[model samples]
Target: MHKSRTNFVFGEGDKNASLLLIGEAPGAQEDLEGRPFVGRSGKLLDKILKAIDRDRFNDTYICNILKCRPPENRNPSLSEIDECKPYLNHQIKLINPKLIVTLGLVAASTLLGKDSSLKDMRNNIFYYMNYPVLVTYHPAFLLRSPSFKRNAWEDFKRIRDYIKD
Candidate 1:
Protein backbone atom coordinates (compact mmCIF):
# COMPACT_ATOMS: atom_id res chain seq x y z
CA MET A 1 0.00 0.00 0.00
CA HIS A 2 2.78 2.40 0.89
CA LYS A 3 4.46 1.48 -2.37
CA SER A 4 1.45 2.70 -4.36
CA ARG A 5 0.79 5.77 -2.28
CA THR A 6 2.17 9.15 -3.32
CA ASN A 7 3.01 10.08 0.24
CA PHE A 8 2.40 8.95 3.78
CA VAL A 9 0.08 11.40 5.49
CA PHE A 10 1.12 10.69 9.02
CA GLY A 11 -0.18 13.71 10.97
CA GLU A 12 0.47 17.31 11.92
CA GLY A 13 0.13 19.67 14.94
CA ASP A 14 1.47 20.00 18.44
CA LYS A 15 3.54 16.93 19.24
CA ASN A 16 2.96 17.48 22.93
CA ALA A 17 -0.72 18.29 22.73
CA SER A 18 -3.21 16.91 25.19
CA LEU A 19 -5.94 16.77 22.55
CA LEU A 20 -5.82 14.45 19.56
CA LEU A 21 -8.18 14.40 16.59
CA ILE A 22 -8.34 11.22 14.50
CA GLY A 23 -9.95 10.99 11.14
CA GLU A 24 -10.71 8.06 8.86
CA ALA A 25 -8.08 8.55 6.16
CA PRO A 26 -6.50 11.12 3.93
CA GLY A 27 -8.35 12.58 0.95
CA ALA A 28 -6.97 13.48 -2.47
CA GLN A 29 -5.74 16.87 -1.34
CA GLU A 30 -4.17 15.47 1.77
CA ASP A 31 -2.43 12.79 -0.30
CA LEU A 32 -1.13 15.38 -2.73
CA GLU A 33 0.19 17.55 0.07
CA GLY A 34 1.46 14.68 2.24
CA ARG A 35 -0.54 16.09 5.13
CA PRO A 36 -3.70 15.08 6.95
CA PHE A 37 -6.84 17.24 6.92
CA VAL A 38 -5.95 19.87 4.33
CA GLY A 39 -9.03 19.75 2.14
CA ARG A 40 -12.62 20.98 2.59
CA SER A 41 -13.27 18.59 5.42
CA GLY A 42 -10.07 19.84 6.97
CA LYS A 43 -11.22 23.40 6.59
CA LEU A 44 -14.43 22.62 8.48
CA LEU A 45 -12.38 20.82 11.08
CA ASP A 46 -10.38 23.98 11.62
CA LYS A 47 -13.61 25.83 12.23
CA ILE A 48 -14.77 23.19 14.64
CA LEU A 49 -11.52 23.45 16.54
CA LYS A 50 -11.63 27.20 16.59
CA ALA A 51 -15.15 27.09 18.01
CA ILE A 52 -13.72 25.09 20.87
CA ASP A 53 -10.75 27.43 21.35
CA ARG A 54 -8.42 24.77 20.01
CA ASP A 55 -6.18 24.66 16.96
CA ARG A 56 -4.06 21.91 15.59
CA PHE A 57 -0.93 24.02 15.54
CA ASN A 58 -0.89 24.83 19.23
CA ASP A 59 -3.27 22.82 21.37
CA THR A 60 -4.09 19.66 19.47
CA TYR A 61 -2.60 16.90 17.32
CA ILE A 62 -4.33 15.61 14.19
CA CYS A 63 -3.93 12.27 12.47
CA ASN A 64 -5.74 9.62 10.49
CA ILE A 65 -6.30 5.92 11.08
CA LEU A 66 -4.83 5.07 7.72
CA LYS A 67 -1.65 6.89 6.84
CA CYS A 68 -2.49 6.70 3.14
CA ARG A 69 -5.65 7.41 1.23
CA PRO A 70 -7.79 4.54 0.10
CA PRO A 71 -8.65 4.32 -3.59
CA GLU A 72 -11.54 6.57 -4.62
CA ASN A 73 -11.93 7.65 -0.99
CA ARG A 74 -13.59 4.35 -0.18
CA ASN A 75 -13.96 3.08 3.32
CA PRO A 76 -10.84 1.30 4.48
CA SER A 77 -11.07 -2.47 4.55
CA LEU A 78 -10.76 -4.41 7.78
CA SER A 79 -7.39 -5.68 6.67
CA GLU A 80 -6.21 -2.21 5.82
CA ILE A 81 -7.32 -1.00 9.23
CA ASP A 82 -5.66 -3.92 10.95
CA GLU A 83 -2.42 -3.21 9.14
CA CYS A 84 -2.40 0.49 9.96
CA LYS A 85 -3.71 0.40 13.53
CA PRO A 86 -0.33 -0.13 15.10
CA TYR A 87 0.92 3.14 13.70
CA LEU A 88 -2.05 4.97 15.16
CA ASN A 89 -1.57 3.13 18.42
CA HIS A 90 2.04 4.20 18.49
CA GLN A 91 0.96 7.77 17.90
CA ILE A 92 -1.47 7.61 20.83
CA LYS A 93 1.25 6.18 23.00
CA LEU A 94 3.53 9.00 22.01
CA ILE A 95 1.01 11.80 22.32
CA ASN A 96 -0.76 10.44 25.40
CA PRO A 97 -3.56 12.90 24.90
CA LYS A 98 -6.09 13.51 27.62
CA LEU A 99 -8.88 13.54 25.08
CA ILE A 100 -9.34 12.00 21.64
CA VAL A 101 -11.98 13.21 19.19
CA THR A 102 -12.82 10.67 16.51
CA LEU A 103 -14.04 12.50 13.41
CA GLY A 104 -16.18 9.73 11.87
CA LEU A 105 -17.57 6.26 12.23
CA VAL A 106 -14.39 4.67 10.95
CA ALA A 107 -12.27 6.52 13.45
CA ALA A 108 -14.64 5.89 16.34
CA SER A 109 -15.04 2.22 15.53
CA THR A 110 -11.36 1.66 14.96
CA LEU A 111 -10.27 3.39 18.12
CA LEU A 112 -13.09 2.00 20.21
CA GLY A 113 -12.76 -1.53 18.73
CA LYS A 114 -16.49 -1.82 18.20
CA ASP A 115 -18.69 -2.06 15.13
CA SER A 116 -21.71 0.20 15.49
CA SER A 117 -23.66 2.93 13.79
CA LEU A 118 -22.36 6.48 14.05
CA LYS A 119 -25.60 7.53 15.72
CA ASP A 120 -25.06 4.88 18.33
CA MET A 121 -21.60 6.23 19.00
CA ARG A 122 -22.16 9.94 19.01
CA ASN A 123 -22.87 12.19 22.01
CA ASN A 124 -21.05 9.74 24.21
CA ILE A 125 -17.54 9.27 25.47
CA PHE A 126 -15.71 5.98 25.28
CA TYR A 127 -12.33 4.85 26.47
CA TYR A 128 -9.49 3.90 24.19
CA MET A 129 -6.38 2.74 25.96
CA ASN A 130 -7.86 4.60 28.95
CA TYR A 131 -7.93 7.91 27.07
CA PRO A 132 -11.35 9.58 26.84
CA VAL A 133 -12.64 9.41 23.25
CA LEU A 134 -15.52 11.41 21.85
CA VAL A 135 -17.22 10.31 18.63
CA THR A 136 -18.55 12.76 16.05
CA TYR A 137 -19.57 12.93 12.40
CA HIS A 138 -16.78 13.37 9.91
CA PRO A 139 -16.57 16.80 8.40
CA ALA A 140 -17.18 15.29 4.97
CA PHE A 141 -20.42 13.81 6.20
CA LEU A 142 -21.42 17.11 7.72
CA LEU A 143 -20.63 18.85 4.43
CA ARG A 144 -22.97 16.47 2.66
CA SER A 145 -25.67 16.47 5.32
CA PRO A 146 -25.69 19.83 6.93
CA SER A 147 -28.47 18.73 9.27
CA PHE A 148 -25.93 16.75 11.22
CA LYS A 149 -23.80 19.77 11.92
CA ARG A 150 -25.80 20.40 15.07
CA ASN A 151 -25.04 16.95 16.33
CA ALA A 152 -21.38 17.27 15.47
CA TRP A 153 -21.29 20.57 17.28
CA GLU A 154 -22.74 18.92 20.33
CA ASP A 155 -19.94 16.38 20.24
CA PHE A 156 -17.37 19.12 19.89
CA LYS A 157 -18.79 20.90 22.90
CA ARG A 158 -18.24 17.76 24.91
CA ILE A 159 -14.67 17.73 23.69
CA ARG A 160 -14.20 21.37 24.61
CA ASP A 161 -15.54 20.76 28.10
CA TYR A 162 -13.38 17.68 28.54
CA ILE A 163 -10.24 19.56 27.57
CA LYS A 164 -11.15 22.43 29.87
CA ASP A 165 -10.91 20.09 32.83
Candidate 2:
Protein backbone atom coordinates (compact mmCIF):
# COMPACT_ATOMS: atom_id res chain seq x y z
CA MET A 1 0.00 0.00 0.00
CA HIS A 2 2.88 2.36 0.72
CA LYS A 3 4.91 1.42 -2.32
CA SER A 4 3.93 4.49 -4.25
CA ARG A 5 4.18 6.85 -1.33
CA THR A 6 6.84 9.54 -1.30
CA ASN A 7 7.60 9.32 2.37
CA PHE A 8 7.32 6.28 4.59
CA VAL A 9 7.19 6.81 8.33
CA PHE A 10 8.97 3.77 9.71
CA GLY A 11 9.60 2.84 13.31
CA GLU A 12 11.92 4.90 15.50
CA GLY A 13 13.55 4.99 18.97
CA ASP A 14 15.53 2.25 20.71
CA LYS A 15 15.34 -0.83 18.53
CA ASN A 16 16.38 -2.95 21.49
CA ALA A 17 13.85 -1.48 23.90
CA SER A 18 11.49 -3.86 25.63
CA LEU A 19 8.60 -1.39 25.37
CA LEU A 20 6.88 -0.49 22.13
CA LEU A 21 4.25 2.20 21.39
CA ILE A 22 2.09 1.90 18.33
CA GLY A 23 -0.06 4.72 17.00
CA GLU A 24 -2.75 4.59 14.35
CA ALA A 25 -1.02 6.42 11.52
CA PRO A 26 1.21 9.35 10.72
CA GLY A 27 -0.05 12.92 10.36
CA ALA A 28 1.03 15.72 8.03
CA GLN A 29 4.16 16.59 9.96
CA GLU A 30 5.18 12.96 10.33
CA ASP A 31 4.58 12.35 6.65
CA LEU A 32 6.86 15.25 5.82
CA GLU A 33 9.56 14.20 8.26
CA GLY A 34 9.31 10.50 7.59
CA ARG A 35 9.06 9.86 11.31
CA PRO A 36 6.25 8.89 13.64
CA PHE A 37 4.95 11.21 16.35
CA VAL A 38 6.61 14.47 15.23
CA GLY A 39 3.62 16.80 15.32
CA ARG A 40 1.71 18.45 18.15
CA SER A 41 0.61 15.03 19.32
CA GLY A 42 4.23 13.96 19.24
CA LYS A 43 5.19 16.79 21.54
CA LEU A 44 2.53 15.76 24.04
CA LEU A 45 3.67 12.14 23.85
CA ASP A 46 7.22 13.23 24.62
CA LYS A 47 6.06 15.03 27.76
CA ILE A 48 4.02 12.05 28.86
CA LEU A 49 7.04 9.76 28.47
CA LYS A 50 9.27 12.23 30.28
CA ALA A 51 6.90 12.34 33.23
CA ILE A 52 7.40 8.59 33.65
CA ASP A 53 11.17 8.71 33.08
CA ARG A 54 10.90 6.90 29.76
CA ASP A 55 12.33 8.55 26.71
CA ARG A 56 11.49 7.33 23.29
CA PHE A 57 15.11 7.48 22.27
CA ASN A 58 16.25 5.58 25.31
CA ASP A 59 13.45 3.40 26.59
CA THR A 60 10.85 2.69 23.97
CA TYR A 61 10.22 2.05 20.29
CA ILE A 62 7.49 4.04 18.48
CA CYS A 63 5.75 3.36 15.23
CA ASN A 64 2.35 3.36 13.58
CA ILE A 65 0.04 0.78 12.08
CA LEU A 66 0.27 2.53 8.72
CA LYS A 67 3.50 3.73 7.14
CA CYS A 68 1.96 6.35 4.91
CA ARG A 69 -0.30 9.11 6.07
CA PRO A 70 -3.88 8.81 4.97
CA PRO A 71 -5.02 11.74 2.85
CA GLU A 72 -5.96 14.79 4.97
CA ASN A 73 -5.26 12.79 8.10
CA ARG A 74 -8.37 10.70 7.82
CA ASN A 75 -8.50 7.32 9.47
CA PRO A 76 -6.90 4.51 7.54
CA SER A 77 -9.26 2.27 5.60
CA LEU A 78 -9.52 -1.45 6.21
CA SER A 79 -7.79 -2.39 2.97
CA GLU A 80 -4.93 -0.05 3.77
CA ILE A 81 -4.60 -1.56 7.20
CA ASP A 82 -4.66 -5.05 5.76
CA GLU A 83 -1.82 -4.18 3.40
CA CYS A 84 0.28 -2.69 6.19
CA LYS A 85 -0.38 -5.28 8.87
CA PRO A 86 2.54 -7.48 7.85
CA TYR A 87 5.01 -4.65 8.20
CA LEU A 88 3.80 -3.92 11.72
CA ASN A 89 4.00 -7.61 12.55
CA HIS A 90 7.56 -7.68 11.30
CA GLN A 91 8.40 -4.68 13.45
CA ILE A 92 7.02 -6.33 16.54
CA LYS A 93 8.98 -9.48 15.75
CA LEU A 94 12.20 -7.55 15.31
CA ILE A 95 11.78 -5.42 18.42
CA ASN A 96 10.67 -8.34 20.55
CA PRO A 97 9.18 -6.01 23.12
CA LYS A 98 7.94 -7.40 26.41
CA LEU A 99 5.05 -4.92 26.36
CA ILE A 100 3.18 -3.12 23.63
CA VAL A 101 1.05 0.02 24.04
CA THR A 102 -1.57 0.73 21.42
CA LEU A 103 -2.58 4.36 21.08
CA GLY A 104 -6.25 4.82 20.17
CA LEU A 105 -8.87 2.45 18.84
CA VAL A 106 -7.53 1.85 15.35
CA ALA A 107 -4.23 0.56 16.62
CA ALA A 108 -5.78 -1.48 19.40
CA SER A 109 -8.26 -2.98 16.98
CA THR A 110 -5.64 -3.68 14.37
CA LEU A 111 -3.26 -5.28 16.81
CA LEU A 112 -5.88 -7.11 18.80
CA GLY A 113 -7.97 -8.16 15.79
CA LYS A 114 -11.20 -6.79 17.20
CA ASP A 115 -13.27 -3.62 17.38
CA SER A 116 -14.00 -2.18 20.78
CA SER A 117 -14.37 1.17 22.47
CA LEU A 118 -11.40 2.72 24.25
CA LYS A 119 -13.31 2.54 27.53
CA ASP A 120 -13.63 -1.20 27.11
CA MET A 121 -9.98 -1.63 26.22
CA ARG A 122 -8.21 0.64 28.67
CA ASN A 123 -6.95 0.00 32.20
CA ASN A 124 -6.37 -3.66 31.39
CA ILE A 125 -3.95 -5.97 29.70
CA PHE A 126 -4.26 -7.95 26.53
CA TYR A 127 -1.78 -9.93 24.47
CA TYR A 128 -0.50 -9.78 20.95
CA MET A 129 1.92 -12.43 19.77
CA ASN A 130 2.42 -13.22 23.46
CA TYR A 131 3.50 -9.70 24.33
CA PRO A 132 1.50 -7.86 26.96
CA VAL A 133 -0.60 -5.10 25.40
CA LEU A 134 -2.04 -2.01 27.00
CA VAL A 135 -4.57 0.30 25.40
CA THR A 136 -4.60 4.06 25.75
CA TYR A 137 -5.99 7.18 24.12
CA HIS A 138 -3.88 8.65 21.40
CA PRO A 139 -2.02 11.86 22.11
CA ALA A 140 -4.06 13.49 19.38
CA PHE A 141 -7.22 12.48 21.13
CA LEU A 142 -5.95 13.77 24.42
CA LEU A 143 -5.04 17.00 22.71
CA ARG A 144 -8.58 17.41 21.48
CA SER A 145 -10.11 16.29 24.73
CA PRO A 146 -7.87 17.60 27.51
CA SER A 147 -10.35 16.19 29.98
CA PHE A 148 -8.97 12.73 29.31
CA LYS A 149 -5.38 13.64 30.04
CA ARG A 150 -5.76 12.40 33.56
CA ASN A 151 -6.84 9.01 32.39
CA ALA A 152 -3.99 8.93 29.92
CA TRP A 153 -1.55 9.83 32.66
CA GLU A 154 -2.85 7.00 34.79
CA ASP A 155 -2.33 4.65 31.88
CA PHE A 156 1.19 5.96 31.42
CA LYS A 157 1.93 5.40 35.07
CA ARG A 158 0.86 1.82 34.70
CA ILE A 159 3.12 1.51 31.71
CA ARG A 160 6.02 2.90 33.72
CA ASP A 161 5.43 0.49 36.57
CA TYR A 162 5.16 -2.41 34.16
CA ILE A 163 8.46 -1.51 32.54
CA LYS A 164 10.14 -1.21 35.93
CA ASP A 165 9.05 -4.74 36.75
Of candidate 2, the 10-residue stretch with the lowest lDDT total is 1-10
Q: What local lDDT score does residue 38 receive in model 2, on the 0 to 100 scale?
A: 92
The lDDT values for all models are: 0.90, 0.92
For residues 61-106, write the lDDT of model 2, one tens digit per residue.
9999999988867889999999999999999999999899999999
Alpha-carbon deviation at 95 in model 2, angstroms: 0.4
| Residue ranges of candidate 1 with Cα displaced over 4 Å | none
Angstrom error at residue 131, model 1: 0.9
True lDDT of residue 130, candidate 1: 92
Best lDDT goes to which candidate? 2
TM-score of each candidate?
0.96, 0.96
